[model samples]
Target chain A: MNLYLGVDIGSVSSNFILLDQNGRLYRKLYLRTLGNPVKALKDGYASISDGLDKQHGKIRAVGSTGSGRHLAAVLLGADVVKNEITAHAVAASHLFPGAKTIIEIGGQDSKIIILRNNIVHDFAMNTVCAAGTGSFLDQQSARLNIPIQEFGDYAVKSGHPVRIAGRCGVFAESDMIHKQQMGFPVEDIIMGLCEALVRNYLNNVGKGKKIEEPVVFQGGVAANRGLAKAFEKILGLKINVPAHYEVMGAIGAAILAREQMELSHSPTRFRGDNFVLEGNFTSNSHECSGCPNLCEVVCIKRDNEVLAYWGDRCKKWESSIKQPRDRLKVV
Target chain B: MSRVGIPRSLFYYYYYPLWKSFFADLGAEILTSAPSNRHTVERGIELAVDETCFPIKVYLGHVAELCREELDYIFVPRLVSVEARSYICPKFMGLPDMVRALIKETPPLIDITVDLSCDEKCFQKDIIRVGRLFTRQARKIQLAYQHGCEELRLCRSLASQGFTMEEAIKMWEGEPMEAESETDLNIGVLGHGYSLYDERISMNLVKRLRAMNCKVLLPEHLGSEVVEAEAATVPKRVFWTLGRKMLGSALHMSQREDVDGIIYLACFGCGPDSLIGEIIERKVRDNKPFILLTVDEHSGEAGIITRLEAFCDMLRRRRNYRSESKLSPYGASLHSFENTV
Candidate 1:
């Protein structure tokens, strides 16, 4: 059996997944990136190494995704590097072939991907704040001395969900603490926080976009039943959280790699099996004043012809490929 | 050889010969610009402030065209009224102030005031005061004043005879004219028609100006110079109407650094000049003092001259101030309100 590996190294968390050619998700691990994705990948690899059935299957292709996908690709010698939007969309499309809306909420940020006829129509990302994301809940959980894993279970039991401010991360913490001092029940406060976060998401990040049904909510935050319940209550529809909740980016990445491999007539350019064992590589950036816009650009050069390029509003510095689809390679 | 710049619009038709004779008697030069055109109008609109109206905006355009020549000064005469009771817009009285503020860069401004708004005694005093600035010589001043006065009387009679400018010019050209109109130093002389077409209209503007006994020009003389100079003061290349006016006017005023005053002929209740005349007043008042003559049929020739004489004299005093004082080189910031907006 041939195995395909995918890694998604995001700002807050990292995930690794393995898939078989039959399109089965074989192995997956999701862990906090903790500002150091290289180590997070190693930890994920450690989990994979423990779980590998070495005699039966061999790792054939590797893919990377997320903001730190280039770094992951450089470190793991990924055969494919994809953007987070594409990775998330592909994973959703594969599971629910007619997925219309893919809402991925994570620790630091959230993304809303709109799909039509299995192709991306439009998308929005909430990079400006953490008000509607999982980390907001984490901050509230820390202040309440409630382990986040139990916060959701408590919300499921709440009869009277007390209100708390969740407009901004800094302000929400203070407001949550104030409600706790006022002797509101922990479950109600937690549920209120969940509702506030969902409302914040709908208002700012979800501003000016049509929200259609067949919505798939998958990210690290999908595990929080309380937030899922709050989104359902506000949106007035059933929310689908995929079974591979935490590692969808990874699953998406592996799938994209498989797609690219099928198109590549040449031999695979991925390095070797010991690629993940190699020490981490670093990335750097510089300002390009080539035009009036003066776009500051990031250059991630494993050797130098940018393994990945971003931060240009005009996308002038993005990686190129011999084929147009190869470059615009979604998922 | 008082060459006068009859900026095609306002008082040039009436007063070209009055100024021609006055400056001719003084043996001074007058320069004028070419006639206003689409390009000139565009240039004027580009230079003037945004709020100025069409006619004054166009007047600024003509003056701007005139300022491009290497002339002594472009004449923009200021008049209070032809009659005692009626008056032009307040913008005429304040045009120098307006021009100075809007277009910051340029050469010196020559301003002459007409305070007929007060009385006749004050008007004469103001005239003498303006004359004194030009020269300290009482004898030369009196002679110039006499020549200016006689020329005005003669031109008025000729104007009252109702001779068309073309016929009068044909007749004037027929004689072995003692002193001819200035053909050098082209500039556009702009003002109201009653002021420009009737020599009596601009208070004997042409004869007195022509009496300078120097080269003269009119609005029909503009060309590449105005366009180039006007563009120099603008922030960015904008195709605004008033911007062209202010720019053209500034460029024209800068050329007449030596002119004792600039005379502007603005009409009463003329909406366009209200704001544009203000911009012109602000821009040219400081560097180059100008006279604003607002003309109605009710306009007083005496009052217009009183204003014109005072403006001319103010230019003389401005020269003294310029020489004696530690003058700051005209600090015109190239950046206008236009850039960020």
Candidate 2:
């Protein structure tokens, strides 16, 4: 009953998942990062490990993904640290075996992955712009005096969605305001905003990509029924949202960890539940004046013991530490 | 003895060997601005006009650094065209005037206009005119120019042996560079020399790839004739010199059996890159994995790392899966989940 753990520490949310030996989801937990990934990761891990008996089995390996993947790997002793794109693609293809396309819109980024025969053929991520992501939806929901959880319900009730500029976030906000001033129905405006975001996602992230069915939509943003419906309307295809869409990245990581452990036959890198629960972690950064680059090198520590160092261009600070496990590898 | 300062930006990556040798042969002490760093980028951003590309802005920063030195002259060449019917970017053509307008209290500039578009006679005359500043010997100037051409050829030849233009230049300057070890992946990286070679501008892209156990294939690795032939397949000739090279190089790389994937580094505001990037994206064939990474002042290293990692993973997975089924190329035998678990 050995279990593999996967953790996805993203910009907005941190998700954890456990996969049994047979590659079935055993347990999952999702928590808001709240601008502090260290706390979110610890809390999520604690919650997932709680109330589990010996019958559930011990963790074998750990895999991490998303924007804070490197940070999570350092803290969690992850066996594999993967990017969000690969993680999402893996999870999508696993859940829906024939999933040819994946539309992943998370807190600050959106991506479209085109898969051929369950293999990722092509992919594109939003470049330098967070025009249509969960963060924007959160901000708009707050401005509209509607809770983000109920935003989809409001959108679905709309008769006609008003047109709003979606090329840029700033422009879209202004257009939303103008539409609001023009006395459009609140539901219609909300639905229109959803439509505009879909348009932006297609034009930017999905540009030149042949998005065939069956398209699987995941990430934290997939929870929004309005956005899901909007994708269906625009792409004119049935979009499948996995039961655990919010934690697909974590699931993918878990699957990868399971695979890695089987291939390498290596012992679990998981530091154990006690290590995560008891370790006192803190990080500090300082500008290195060694040269004109002035790279801001960051040091991560657990109590008094230094764990890792990064951010120097010349690897002066990074290589100074003798810990082979703390070395930053891009993969 | 006359001192001439050369800003280490833009055309410096391409023609630095030629200029250095030319000046040294004429008995002029050559001083190049230090490699680009945070201070250089910041100063350039402040001094340069808002609309110019990042390399041009960096060039201005290098010029500003040159101004700090008590040199007798700074060499800010007005490069219009190097080959017939092919021109450098308009920014290079107006670089001398831009530097003059932006920076005050600068030393005398030997702003030689190098235009070999229609003919090489005027360029030869311009080269001699600049040489006169160091020595009055007409034969000496001609010989210096010949030595410069010879040095340039050596640099290019060194580059074709699998080193970046910057590394080749360093080797040309007698710097000992270790040969890169063989790796599992062969990645074709294409971009303008100034933007791509400058570790700061490209955020150490080539070094990062090498560290990730990849052999980087640069445009310089391909011969000019091969690149030109590939580029000529286009419906219309690319007029921009660097742009043409990029197109030709990308096309050539796409067809190479050894090359796995191609990555194009493009600046956000570059006019030539805006068009050239799209053309390369469309022109690249054989379903070769191509990713156009756009960088600017606001580019974060995290974004770049994520993209690079994903791209590398994609290539590795594709290669592994392809090798597993050599007989049936597109066989459905590999159930990704089952295979992994």
Candidate 3:
């Protein structure tokens, strides 16, 4: 069997997925990044490939997405490195053919993608604010001494949700504390928090856009049934959460990788499981005094052999590496 | 010869050619602050008040850069209105006062008030007053101002010919500029000239777009008549000069066939931009795709790169699907999934 691998190294979580030749999900793994994507990626890869032999399948190609996509591409020889928006849109459209809207709220960012005829017609991401994202929810849940998995259950039991300010995260937390001091039910407060986050996402990320039916909600936050229910209640439309909503970014990347491989008919750039598991990969950054820009250039190395360089505005350091594959040639 | 300093921010992108020409012709050597860099932004943030917009902070930094240099005078103009019925931003009107209040030590400022709201008579008088510092001859000052206007026309022409204002200004100063290469995408970019033209401030937005095989279209590319006509389509007239120009440019681009999409680069705390950006977004919402990118002191390149890449991907995919629809009888096909075996 031929398997394509997809990796998403986000701020809060790292996800890995494998797609078979027929574009079916073969294997998936989700792990906490814990502020270190490199360790998470290596550990996730090792766990997914453990006990798998050459007779089982060969890794054909690799794709990466999310905020750390460029870093992921450098670590793993990725055939395609796409932004989260494109990856999410592609995955949603592929799974739900009639999906016209996609609401993706990840660790630190939320986005609304409007699709028309299976192509992205318009999209908007939260600008300079992560107030209503998964990280905030996680912080609130942790402060309330409620397990994140059970946060939605608390919301579902609420009779009336109290209004909390959702414009800013700091204000929302204070408002939640205020509501708690006022002796409001904890369930009602949780449900109020969910409603407030939904309002923020719609007003900020989904502003001025017409969101139609067949809306597909994904990303790590999609696991929260409260958000899905809130979205359905507010938009007055059914929210469809796919079976693999948490790893949709990884799945989309895999689909894009498959498409790229088929289009180019090129050999797989996969470094293999041995290189990923055993290769000592390290990265370091230094401020380049080359002129007054003082760009902090970062260098990634694999066992002392420099793998890639970036962060310079002039591309002087980036171009120093002559490897053709290091350059992101998006078609 | 008198040495005059001009901080390269704000109106510098728009009026640098005229200032350089007028000062040079009046027998004064023109010295502009070094192009904005990390130190410039840092110093600007340190010296400027926190409430001011990013461009104003950068302008303060440029002034600080000039104060370090041995100079006769620094020209900080109080620009109220450039044309009739439209004013510049309110911050620009108080820029000279702000500089005086903020900078600890500085050369004597040749702060001239250029208000052409009703007529250019007062502006001409102020121009001669500034020129008198360099030369006493009134006839010589008039000729120099005329020469400056001629040079400004040449620079504006260069800008309309697909060069950035910075490049055009450099070209006007006899510097050689490389022409843009062939591009696959036509992206219409709108923003205030100060923020848009400064490479450091805009994070090399135009250069990045060009590297991505995009031909950038700016408001300078359109004639004033065209811009004014498009801007007049709004029910209420835009009172801000740059704001009006941006709205007109955005409206024009939304209807242009060659243009794929529009990107508005706005400073986070700009008052005029807050209103202008919202209006442009609503006006161009239905006609074409638009993305509002608000940049600030944060220098993280990841968010910018991701947004640009995704925006370009959206435009390309939409274009491909539209073109594919033309070829097939069964409407548009999913190009990415066609070869899935």
Candidate 4:
């Protein structure tokens, strides 16, 4: 079997997934990004590569998504680099063919995607708020001295879930403290937090959009059954959580890579194990004062040779790397 | 000649030529503030209140830039209204006062009230009041106003015909229209003139779309009468002049079959736009492919480029799918939206 790889590098977490030629997921791994994407991708790739039995498959094509997609594409020689919106929608519609809506709650950001017949109709992402996302829940779990894995179990056991203000993180935190001081049970407070997150996601990300069923919930936050239950109760529908919920972005990217390869009929630009494992790659950034904007441009290098320059407002620096040999070898 | 500086932020692209010709005809030199850059935005961020919109902050930056020019007077006008019964944003109404309060050691401001809400005579009186500072003759002021109007008419025509502000200004100066080749794809860009026209904030969106072989449409391109008619189709009419114009033009473009998609470039934390944007969203619904890009000073170029690429790819895919399947691509497809039924 031939394997396709997908990597999703977000702010809080980096996900890696491997899929066979038949579009079945073989292996998936979710790891904390911890502010270093290059390290996360390298470590995730190594562990996934080790798990692969020699008789099973060889890596064929690679795709990347999420906010740090460009960095991943440059680091891994991605054949297809896409946004998280497309990747998530693709995976959701693929798994639950009738999924009309997808609510993806990640660590730092959340998004709602409405689909029509397996096509993205409308979508909105959280712009300036990170209150109801996975990071917020993680902070509350740490403060409450409860393991994150057991948070949903506590909420599920609650008979009454209180209403916590979910408009902003600051408001939610203060409200949680106030509720705790007022003698609310820990399970009830946990359930309230889950409800607050669902409400925030609905009002902000799902504002004014038609959110029809069959809805599929995925992302790192979807692991919390408490949040899933709250969403199902508020929306009055059965929310489907796919088996590979945490790494859906990676799965979607892998599916896109397979589609692109089949459509173009080209050989995969995987660069093989030697280039990824043994090659010395170093990245550095500098403020380009070419114009008054003073854009901070990041450049990746392979043994002191510039591979690509990005984050440039005016392509002055990016346009300078114009060697065909370097072009194919780099981006 | 006495020098007067104009900040090139809000309404500069729309009325620059008029003001330029008006000032020049009165024998006064006109200096425009530099185009918005990162330094300008940073200065604005440092000076402006946190609650203000991004464009207003950019305007402050422009004003700060203008302060360095050592002009005799800065032309900061109080634009209350352009048409009868319509108001402008409160920021425009209080801009000159804000400048006076915020910036120290400012040159004398040539503040003029151009409110057409009162009557035509009031507009004439306002112009004449500002004109007296330059010349004492009534005939000279009248002639300058007429010349300004003529130049403005030409600029508006050029802009409506798909010329950018820079291109239109160049055309008004007797230069050839440059690199405006036509493409099959058409995209309607809905936003205030300030956000859509500013290359720095918009990240050169019009040029970027044009480079991808798509014709860009703006609200200013449509006639006011047509826009008003389109706006009346909604339940309640928008009161703000620019807000009404943006909403009207978006509604008009949503009905246009040639327009493949609509991209709304909005300012982050814009109060009026946050409300009107929802209306535009409800109107467009699933009828068209709509993408709302909220831009602020901290918006990253790579992220915007990625979204643009994804949106363009989606439009292309929809076009191909429609042509292949010969099904209606507009609104909810027959195979879609039947889940509830």
Candidate 5:
């Protein structure tokens, strides 16, 4: 079988997906980024390789997305690189062709994508505020001494969800503490927090955006049934969560890779499974004193040869590596 | 000869040459605060009011920098209006006072109220008023004003002909002109001149768009008459000069078939932009693809670049598909996935 690989390295978590030529999911791995994406990528690849037998399929193409997309693409020789918005929108459209709106609440960021006929019509992402994200819930759940996976269960068991302030994280935390001191049930507080976050998401990220029917919710936060229930109730619409909710970005990237390869009719640049297992990777960065901008340039090396350099605003360093317009070769 | 300092912010982009020539003609040495950088923004954040927008904070930083230079007289004019029934922002109207309150031991300010709404004569009178501070001769002041006006006209012409403020200034100083190449995409960039032209403030937005093979059209490039004509179409007129220009240019661009899309660059926490951005968004929301990118000191480059790349990809794909299916009026249909759920 021919396979494709996609990796999404976000600030909070890293997700990986392996898809067959027929668009069938072969393996998925989700792990915490923990401020070390390079290590996370290596560990993810190790686990994915272990899951498949020795006679596993030939990896055809690879793609990467999220905040660390460039780093991942350079590291893995990805044929395609995309942003989280495109990756999410592509994945949502594939999962639900008729989806007009996508509510993606991830570990550290939340975004609302409006679509029309499978095209991304408009999008808005959370800025300067962490009032509506999974990380906020994770912090609250830890303080409440409940497992994050059980957060939605507690909300579901609530007989009456109380009103909690969610305009900002600090206010929400203090409000939750106040409510707890007043002896509100743990389930009620959890449900109230979920409702507040949903309301915040709608008011902020979904503000001024037309929320159409056939809405799809996907991300790590989609695992929380309580948030999904709150979203459905508030919007007065049914929300669809795909089976591979956590790894949708990776899946979308894989889909993008397939599309790119098919359009160009070029061979895949996949370095193979052994590339991650046996490759010796080292990285270094230096501030270029060439100009006043003082851009910090970073470069990756494989087996003592420079593969790629980025982070330069002027592209002076990046261009020198690809001066003659040659294809990226893996040593 | 006394030295005069000008804070390089806000209306500085529009009227700096006029002021520079006027000051030079008056025999005073002209000094300007440096272009905004990370240190400037940090200083502004430390000195400015918490509720003020990012640009205004940067302005305060410029003013503070001028204060440190100890110039004899700093020019902080109160720009009320350039046209009738339209006002500049309240911040511009009260800029001198704000600088006064923010900085102690500041140099004497050449604070003159310029209200051109009454008539064109007011502009001349305001110039004469500032010129009096340097010299008392009427003929000298008139000569300087004429020279200043001529230079201002040249600057405006160069700007409307698609030259950036920096490029126009360089050309004025006898710098060789660089050839402007044609590109496939015509993107209308609408924003305040300060924010749009300042590379550090906007994260080099125009350069990035150009690097992506887009021919950028700034609001200043579209003449004032064109902007005014388009602004009149809105139900309620935009009161702020820059706001009116941006909104008007956006409306004009939306109606044009050649302009692929509109990108509105706004500084975070700007009151006028918050309203103008919404109006422009509503006007062009259906007609063309509109991207409203808000920038602050805290915005990371990685996040911004990702959004920009995605937007560019979408535009490229749309343009390619439209051309491929030229026979169809609405173009070929994009594939939609089956609703598996």
Candidate 6:
């Protein structure tokens, strides 16, 4: 029972999925990444349980994606560690064949993917805009005395959505409070906020792009029906949210692992699950004075040949073959 | 008591008047190498690492020549930006740092700050800041800057009035050779400053393509005024400096039915060019069977010309059927690279 594993670790949460032959999933787990991704991997490994432990059920190849994919790959001995864009796009295509566009608003960033012939023709990412991301919505929800879980329901109930400044996060807050003082309904205000966020994304980041139809919206924001409605109104097109919308990145990564494993015809890079069962996997760092960006490169190694290296923008201290590229065996 | 060194390839070809005037105003002599020859290019590659793009390599080679002349300050403009929302490539933006790191030369570089990215007033303030680093006298620096600006204005205006560079040169230095054999195969070239000038890496395509009887029209040939005028058609109001220049060049070139084909010189690892170039290619590539040539330090001249020759051959046969090149039936003064018209 050869199986492939994929892990996506983010600032907010960590996702783990395992898939067997014919791309049929076996196990999947979503755990808050917290600060220490090492612990999250251990927690996920524990959740996957004893099924993968048997000699017959071998872990063939493992791939990692997300902000923490590099370190996770090193710990998990992942065969591939890809950037979020490729991982998300690959998974979206699999989930919805011939997916034209993927609008991903994660905890920290938002991305627009335009795909053609099951291939990504172009993509744009906006890490600069904090106002359009899920984290901003979370903060706004907390301030307005609205539970994040009920945000979608409240937004849909609005009669008249109030307009809020979407250019800056700070400005949006002041404008939001002003509307509330003016006797605007909470539901209406919430819906307005969602519309404003969508407007900001389209105006700033999505500018100059030809956003075609068959759109798939994923990441944490997919939970918000109000935002979905806002997008539909603005684009004049229906949007698709994959079944595993929140964890599509992880699911895509798992699919990549399965694809690579079948092609490699070798043993898995999944450094035994005991990697977590063992004591603290130690790491060290040093200042690489390559450029002005004095990247505090962290090198994680249990024993000798450095298992994983990260924290440098230029990949200064990255494991020789580079993060994701190292996953491939050229031989 | 000190001299200035300038690279002959890039800004030199166009900004020589302004740069030369600025140094002269500062009461300093100038030293620049002869037009790029093959050995100059080879030496440029030796001074620069392989990863740098074309213009950088030519710049390095120009620096190598300047090193022998024994100059004190090389006028390396931290050409930050020319306009808001537009910027030179990150490579150009980070050039001074890259040069200091790469070149072992002992001369301290005079960073002529041209940061137009910031508002004009602030950009001027930074220029003055760099000027203060040179001379203590305020009046002389201002005078030099004014004189330098006057020369640039004159260059731009002359280019605008459709004065043949030869005719305009007669106004400055007397008439030169009546451009021998006016019947050269006309072709339009679109690319960054570095790709066109850096002969070694961009494989010095202009001269080679010219030698093959093809007339090379550079981005500089497309006057800024004409580009700005036609650029109004773009709905995005995309005002990025290089982006505007690129689109303007493509649009202006597109209207010329006489041009057999267009060559878009692209650089490896350049982000803005990749995005904007793709946009232009999607729109204008099929309009005339254009070829996109990419260059890095490792690019071979042989491979480049082979592609160009293939493109020209395809053009010569008229076998390539693209949308008809846009030419007003009246032939209303088709755009010229050297002239705004």
- TM-score: which candidate is best? 3
Docking class of 6: incorrect
* Candidate 1 global CA lDDT score: 0.60
Candidate 4 per-residue lDDT over residues B10-45, each given as its tens digit: 878778889989989999999987778878888888
Write model 1 residue lDDT over B312-334, tens digit each, in one string: 32333334444654321111111
Candidate 3 lDDT by residue in tens digits, A65-95: 9988888887888888889988898888888
* Residues B3-38, model 2: lDDT tens digits: 999999998999999999999999989999988988
At residue A16, candidate 2 shows an lDDT of 94
What DockQ does model 6 achieve? Answer: 0.01
The Cα RMSD in angstroms, rounded to one decimal, for candidate 6 relative to the true structure is 15.8
Tens digits of per-residue lDDT, candidate 6, A1-331, equal 8776778887667888777765656777777777788888778777864566667577777778777776777777777666677778767767677778989988776878776654555555663356878788888889978888799899999988999888888898999899999999999999998899999998766765678889999987888999999999889989998767888788767766765655556667777867756746778898777753355677886656566776654445664634445344210
Q: Give a tens-digit lDDT track for model 1, residues A91-173.
A: 78777878888888977668787766655555556634667677767766787787878888988778877776767867766
The residue-level lDDT of candidate 4 at B153 comes to 92
lDDT of 6 at A78: 76
Ranking by TM-score: 3, 2, 4, 5, 6, 1
DockQ of 2: 0.46
TM-score of chain A of each: 0.84, 0.97, 0.98, 0.94, 0.94, 0.89
Q: For residues B1-341, could you state the per-residue lDDT of candidate 5 as single tens digits?
A: 98999988877878888888888999999999877765677788898989887888988888888888858999999889977877888888888898899888889999888887767787778778788989998789989878887998898788777777766766776787764587878889888888888777888888888876778888878878888999989888778888988888998999999888888998888889989998999889888888888898773787667667667656665576567642211112225222332
Summarize candidate 6's per-residue lDDT along B87-166 as a digit string, tens digits.
76666777777678877864788766676765788766765775675578877787888898888767655543433232
Cα-based lDDT at residue A233, candidate 4: 91
Write model 3 residue lDDT over B61-143, tens digit each, in one string: 99999999999999999999989988999999999899999998899998999888899998999988988898889999999
Evaluate every candidate with DockQ and list the scores: 0.01, 0.46, 0.49, 0.33, 0.32, 0.01
Better of 1 and 4 by TM-score: 4
Model 4 steric clash total = 0
Give residue B165's error in model 5 in angstroms: 3.3
Model 4 sits at an interface RMSD, in angstroms, of: 8.7
Superposed model 3: Cα runs more than 4 Å off? A325-327, B325-341
CA shift at B298, candidate 5, in angstroms?
Answer: 0.7
